[model samples]
Target: MKQPLADAPASDAGRLQVPTAVLPLAFGVLGLVVAGAALALWVIPAVPRLTIIGDELVGLSYIVAGTIAWLRRPSNRIGPAITGAGITWFIGDFVFVPNAVITALAYALMWLPNLFAAFILLSYPTGRFFSPAARALFLTAVAVSAAQYAVRLFVLDATGDYGCTCRNPFAVLPNVALYDVVMLVTRIVVVLITLVTLVLIVQRWRHASPAGRRQLAPVLFAGAVGLAAFAADITAYNLTKASADAGALGVASVTGTLLVLARTAVPLGLLFGLVRTRLDRALVAQLIVQLGQAPSPERVDEVLAATLHDQTLRVIYWSPAARAYLDGRGRLVEPSAGEGRAIRLVERDGSPLAAIDHDAVLTDDPELLTSVTAALALAVDRGRLETMVRAQAEDSRSFPTGRVTLLYSDIEGSTALLDRLGPRYADLLAEQRRILRGITREHGGREIDSRADEFFAVFPMGSTPLAAAVAIQRRLRDHEWPEGATVKVRIGLHTGEPEIGDEGYVGMDVHFVARLGSAGHGGQILVSQAARDANAGELDHDDLPADFPPPRLAK
Candidate 1:
């Protein structure tokens, strides 16, 4: 089994497996969040004209569920989530509820503590209790929410519009009523809290570590979304505008969804990431092989990435006594002995994706296990190759290279030919790129970059460059091109310098080679100055451009 490195903590469960309870909880939370969002939009404008109804009840259920889960197991994740959701919903509910109306103080009473708790949940890291900064933020929320709640309570007896967004159901009360005083304080405090949160997280990206920042990034994204929604909500409240309501509601719904993604999805993504560490070499290799055989590369990557992130007992191959590949800031990773176990839990942050820990005897020989891991690595590498190829193709119509020969297999007089053969022939020209890439690896070269009418390859370094080039030549020679078209390619050859890097990128070498190849007559291999040099003054080229210098490569 691939063992997790030290520094990464062992998961409570053996796999990135969520309990059955969590699925229902997830659906329920999402449903309420969405439903409430719809309701909030429907009534936010002309809101005072119509009272908030079951919306409050719907919110209460979320709060109750979260709270109940928390009470049952404070150590579990549900508590913080419940606490945050409860407070967030209250904030939403208050926007529509009339202040100085319907036991106005009752609204404040329920919402105050929830505010403090929400801040803590959002700000604090999961592993430990609260950090100093997080605690400070939490306390600040407590002070602010409490101050607003208190002000509301003290002024509850007197009532009026409060001349604020919270339109009191009892506009019958005078503006100077005691209830109005509370409304004034609440607004000031609410505005301040938002401003402070906004400021603290504005530059969070600068200092936080990747893991810390991952956690922080969502908080910041959520804050921005919240503020935007709040602004829209306030605008709707003030304009007495009907159109504003739907826009406001839509924004709120998006904000909630973003929150879910950050809160749930991010962690879930992390779990998927963890799966890579748990699996044995053979199993992971099998998975990778399956990934290669899969019809859709995107589907394979998504599934593999998910499995790596979420599975528990995620295993990482420790090279030996001390060597670690994933070197991100804040974590120095080196191998450690596992005693009887296959892997030790390692620190998290940019480690290689994990595999699952399998108890099966993966191989009788340790050497065989090593071979399996190498094969797994190669398979994953292939998936990445396909991904990069697709990405490059997306950007442009052509990519130049030097490693593999550049052959602009263009049909002669494509424009005239296109009109003659018609758009149906255009299909064949287009099919050209796809077919080339699919068979690139099979030809002992990878289609490093591609575009319309042309695809470039880098001869696989796994084989001798000469052998690899010869293989490519044969493959190109045999390829049918397009039928019933005058498309014939001029081939280029130069073993000169190519900017070779990840994803088959070749630089200047490819350009000169292609230029040479495209020169001379239409049907032959054109050898460049570099190619002649690589040949050690051996081969004679019949195809050289008129102005080009010819080499003494002919021995």
Candidate 2:
């Protein structure tokens, strides 16, 4: 049986894993059910309309935004965590119920929504705690929340803390003074944690890469606003408790309302940050259109930098001749990122063709990086050829400048193969070039030029040219061609002093190698006596034919 293609859509396993299209619909129905329950709960208690609207707006905004984000990036945990926080918000409404047990239970967990908000803020965007300090702080916050619930259940008088008449069934010691002290301590601890978190967030922004800053901008701004409002509310509430002043109470009420509004912005900002990469696709679309102009390598670097919004971005072309990455000027360069930068590799047929070094934050969105790498493959390949030409010229300066072995190869009956295979012949020819290029580089040879169905390379006056010729013939003969096609290559090798120019080798030695290659049949490696004599000890009967005709200079 034929194997499936890598990109084929996978079959759904079961109903538990919902399709992307149905996820939003499911979440919508669930939201409606929760909303209906919340409305009924608020109505029976006769809660003020403004209070209910405020609560519902803050809660429902979380649900809607969280659901959209979750659906947009199902792989990220932030979405589901935010949705859970919204549900916790609604559950906290049970405090309004008239039943003592339910009301006490609700009061016991009243701080849970705040805990959720803290967790969301601390882990925004990536949903993972970034550092050991962040993780430690979150654990400390959890302990404080747990402590609040314990104090409410065992020691606190509900009438004093929440102004409720409900009985705390588990309150064995209802000491009002002790409860107030404990509450103040916990409140101070919570305030301290929030302040530290805000500080940490600021540090993250300051240290972030250009791409990281972009991803963190919207979410961090919203979180900072919310945290500030929360701190103001806490301080105002503390002032009202310390002094029996109407102004203090009014300030507390205003800050509380501000806190609610600020919290609503949190989810919206998170949603925007999560989908920012999708928005960046618009730039990539523009990049595709711009690439149609077939811009030069420097022009491509500029276009990509603008497209990705990273001024430090670079595009380095792969040079098969030098077997290394090179800049447009043909100078060898390292492709790995340093410090605040990141690198994305470009490949064709599983071979590394080029690489892009940009802001480290670009890796945060693999889809965007992958799209950019894929979009530039053809353009990078085009640039590689130009780079290779420069690389060969630059490399030749270091050559012996005396005698060198030249190897020329051509595919036998390539025109007939093109006639038979048409467009598919291009793939065959490319595979041929890839094989010969790799073999040449492997034997310490530098590729001089490659044109359709032909390749020319030079090696130091040694056995490498003969070795490369043998490997080339062996590789093509053993390769499995598509549609049972047959490919045979003829190779020619000669050792002589050629007129070296910036354009490449010239004169009689270059012409002799070409004519020498045509004198051989398919799968034959013709070697002039000069190349064999230069490396007389290295050649063996097993590696090359025992007989060779005299040198042929004329075509």
Candidate 3:
């Protein structure tokens, strides 16, 4: 059996239960203290008032929003990424310290939070990034940042850059010209990275389905704006002839204030996207109302597609009797979802109930997926019952009452033939059944029941059963059997008013006919006196023996 995606945690019945919010809460408190220290020690004393306030707000926003997201859905890694970004953002403020070693170290690693930003955007919705180009680009950014840090620490002096009055203790051989050249190249590369990031976000949006687009929209909008603003602000500040004035050092200029404001949108957008699952929960509420009681499978499918905003969705019901998943029309269907599709299994009482095939976007929001699936449980079970009923009705044979002729037939030496043919027995059995059914249908006979190599059919009245029996025997003799094996069938005919039951003909007449068929030799037809009397002289036209053996009924 193919295992369900949701069954992962439930597999270990004895696993210890862990509270989801414990770590987030603990880490959130710790992050608050760190952010406070950063603001009090470095930001407030050194930077302009507006920049100090912006730093506090932006850091707090990241931590609070990330904590909430983590509490809401612990499975998504995006939450942790956001929270860690906040902590690292504060940590990077060590660049404002007056100590040479600490400030140099901070300057070397200040791009940590920005790297986190890139990761959060590229891997939006799902925390795990999948695209090869995206992964490569992120790694490239890391490599470039590491190189820049090495160059800044050993090859260049930054005694006055970003208003840092402290001397660079790690500058081994300061070269002003080389520093300018390196800075220029680094700026160009940063611009290129920004452009690539924008292109990637646009590509993702364009390729996404409608449902996927909804999930990506808010985050993409905020991320794109933030990247553009950062690129523009950096270019304008660096390329222009603005002097590195000591008085203006660590001050929040108008452009710096705008940049910080733009940065604030990133966390807000992430928080908005995370909380947006409430809208899906609302849809689930409506879904429950729309479902009501005893809704059809098609209705369940429609409501799910509408609620989830995934139009290409289908529900396949599980039939316990059939031991398979079946469609609304009771046709067998595989649980597999084809290209660009995904399957979510639905279970009742820990047993497989049904599966939903829909667009892959639904997997991004685990909370919504779980909610919608839980809402659909009762409806899917009802649909399963309906599908089973349909299958039973289709398999059942309609029986005729009153006086009727019943014919029973079976392959002679079936066990021995099966042993001889091995796998080829299936082909022989299929051909035999085909011939028997065709002859019975041609002579106005309806099949009452059939199991394996044995067949039981009912005819309306005189001569039809005999005619069908003769035709069956003749076809078996003339047709070439499979596996180069000779095949023969034994037939018995009886006429009586056999009682009809829910499962077709019952009572002694039915039993007698079955037993009589078993007693005959291959290629031979046995008839009872009752049938012979009812259809007198029918054997003459059938080309059967005039002196037929008495019906040998064996119990």
- Model 2's TM-score against the true structure: 0.65
Instruction: Please report how far candidate 2 places residue 12 from its true position, in Å.
Output: 8.8
lDDT of each: 0.43, 0.73, 0.74
Worst 10 residues of 2 by lDDT: 1-10
**Top-down lDDT ranking:** 3, 2, 1
Instruction: Give candidate 1 misplaced runs (Cα > 4 Å).
Output: 1-79, 82-105, 110-131, 158-186, 206-219, 228-462, 465-555
Model 3, 1-555: lDDT tens digits are 445554546635234225566888877898899887777764436655554566789889989988887777677788888888787777556666677787788777666787888888888878878498888888988877777777778876775643367668888988878877776787678878988999999999999989999888887888888888767755765756342211233322444555567667878987777667777788888897776544545667888899988888888766553457767544568888666788888898788777888887888876788788887776655534543353245347566778888899888888999898888787567646655755776678776767788888888774377877887776667555544566778888999999977677899999888888888888888889988877776355445434546545565
What would the per-residue lDDT of candidate 2 be over residues 1-555, giving only the tens digit for each residue? Answer: 111123323554354357854765576557657766767775554344565566688778778877877776676667776776676666656666666777777778766777777777777676788778888999999998888788887886565333246668778899888888887888788888889989999998998867678788877888889888888877876777631111224778788778878888888787776566678887888887776555655778998887777878888766554456766544567776687777777788767788888887666566677778878986666544543463456455654468899999888898988898878787667656766766776677877887788888889865377777887776666555655677887788999999877677889999988888977778888889998887565544374344544534563
- Colliding residue pairs in candidate 2: none
> What's each prediction's clash count?
47, 0, 0
Off by over 4 Å in 3: 6-22, 42-46, 73-75, 162-164, 241-255, 382-555
